[model samples]
Target: MSSMKTYAHVQAKTTRWKLDSKAIDQGIAYGLMIAALFVTYLVH
Candidate 1:
């Protein structure tokens, strides 16, 4: 259908999703906390 083709074209033209610096820093901090907990559990 024409509608389906138009929708596909619009979707293809959309910009890629992005992660900003603040989000990346928070994710890194969360991952580090989980890693520390896992290491502590193994050491006990």
Candidate 2:
């Protein structure tokens, strides 16, 4: 029973961690896209 509880906790933690990383990755991608657009605007 205790092992099952521990396993559940670990699973929850890993899921949350994965979600956080995905959000960070998406934010970085959006930032890079915006930067590229700004650079292109300035060039033209």
Top lDDT prediction, candidate number: 2
Off by over 4 Å in 2: none
* Each prediction's number of clashing residue pairs: 0, 0
Please provide, for model 1 over 1-44, each residue's C-alpha lDDT reduced to its tens digit, 9 standing for 90 to 100: 99999998777656222345567888999999999999999999
Pairs with steric clashes in candidate 1 = none
Instruction: Write the residue-wise lDDT of candidate 2 on 1-44 in tens digits.
Output: 99999999999999999999999999999999999999999999
Q: What is the lDDT of residue 17 in candidate 2?
A: 100
The reply for model 1, stretches above 4 Å from the true place, is 1-19
TM-scores of the candidates in the order shown = 0.56, 0.94
